[model samples]
Target: MPCWFTLTCAVLSIFAFVCVLGSEVNVQRKNLLGLGSLQSVAVSGRLICLGRPAADVKVKLYESEVLLDSKLDEGRTDSNGVFRLSGSKREFTTIDPKLNVYHKCNYNGLCDKKFSIRILVDYVSSGSEAEKTFDIGTLNLANEYSGQTTDCIN
Candidate 1:
């Protein structure tokens, strides 16, 4: 074969091998992190922004994993500023669950300001669905919360 053609073929082969190795490594990482058997959790809460209902706000439930966090469920607050969200993730170990509230309370900007709260690992149930709901009580978004951040993407 021509020298240039041989070099190009070898480079292509190496690239293909790298891609396959990367995929296998990713699978192994997830396996070690234990994101594989079903577990569920449920959360409920009310949000008030400036003494009014925090309507249409976004709320997301996430499984906090070592490799990559997984989004389980998402919902919006009702006219009364109430939300009930439940979701399940498959993990070989206990799942780390959290709730993310994306609201426009007390701010005028693009996307939404994010406030996150972690759910106790005890709340995670051993099944495909949650056995009970965990209420987080009411929150007044007018007051600033520590660890708040801005998230443009959901």
Candidate 2:
């Protein structure tokens, strides 16, 4: 049908494939011991600039405007333009948090739309509590256009 629909279907197919083959992928981290209740979670992603990989960009994770974790030392991306951050994985019963990605607009002064994204974090358990790793993915960002201005002042 349409290009967007075709693209979406392709992406969904890829995701399905990954899910089916997920068990084949090996994890680098070892299982933790001496388990305890859930604590926090981890958030990670890559930053891009001008459709090119950007490095040394800070990604902040927050909980209702309150600073939870900051990746100052983890800063920057690699040649592949990928960055990652890890936090304590909490239980799903607990209230989840939202994370915000901030960056300068590469469009120069062409548009005022801020180049940023918001990701919702939820609990996805693996093995035991002690030997657990939070999984974060499916992050997609949308760009806002300043050209649209229709508001009733009244």
Candidate 3:
């Protein structure tokens, strides 16, 4: 996949798309703005839709940005509904990471239901890789949470 698809632009007040594109569309240029060291994070969890395993659910790790969010890693759930992902980003300030979950769950809809869980700064480690892994435990996709939205594109 192209790098630009991973950079999800934040929704405006009217839910319109806004992207700041230049001649270059690589992630290295985005990191040049920061002289800080590399910070990393690792996460693992299982997803269950209704009462059964939710296989093939899309999961992404991102360092949230004002204009373009950097996608550290992206993958899908295994047959057992298990997923493990680790990624890093270099930033002058503390890296704000978020795990975006895109799943259909038990609903028959035109788009997948999207939800995000913010990784606390306490879990962020300064290095080329993460020293510790944060266990998100089992997530049941049967209930609605705040900031949840429908994503037609993932």
Candidate 4:
């Protein structure tokens, strides 16, 4: 074989290998973005009042002062006063997260007002590709509401 033909064949082989490798890498990246590297947040805690668990209370999670979608980002305390809220999104972004607890532990049904508590959670995400779980520990509802007073408190 001529020297030029041999060199051409070798170069073609390298080019083909590089193309195949590049395509494979692209496919793997797509798969990761589609299913593997999704960002999720899990928030869990317990509601307590007067040394007892407060059951059936509504728990809400907010990001940047906006309420998260209720269908997937809110929960109610169980019989043990434990609640868990989870949310997932495609892109990883830093969030200012807050927890709100609503219950009628203060007054009877006649008051038509419920006690509310707001907790500012320090969850500064590094914007990495990993699931995050925050255990906010137990929230005591026995104390006075420290959050802003709204018209709901009539």
Clashing pairs in 4: none
Candidate No. with top TM-score: 3
lDDT of 1 by residue, 1-154 (tens): 8999999999999999999999978876886787577789999999999889999999999989777789999999999999999998766678899999998898999978998899997789988889988899999988887899999988
Model 4 stretches astray by more than 4 angstroms: 1-39, 65-72, 90-93, 109-130, 148-154
| TM-score for each model | 0.77, 0.41, 0.78, 0.53
Pick the winner on lDDT between candidates 1 and 3.
1
Where does candidate 1 stray beyond 4 Å? 1-36
RMSD, every candidate, angstroms: 5.8, 17.2, 11.9, 14.8
Q: Each model's C-alpha lDDT? A: 0.90, 0.43, 0.85, 0.61
Worst 10-residue lDDT window, candidate 1: 27-36
lDDT of 2 by residue, 29-147 (tens): 21133333354545566555656665544454433322443321234446655665544442324324344444443533332322223344444234323133333443222334333
Q: Which stretches of candidate 3 lie over 4 Å from their true place?
A: 1-30
Candidate 2's clash total is 9
In angstroms, how far off is 103's CA in candidate 1? 0.7
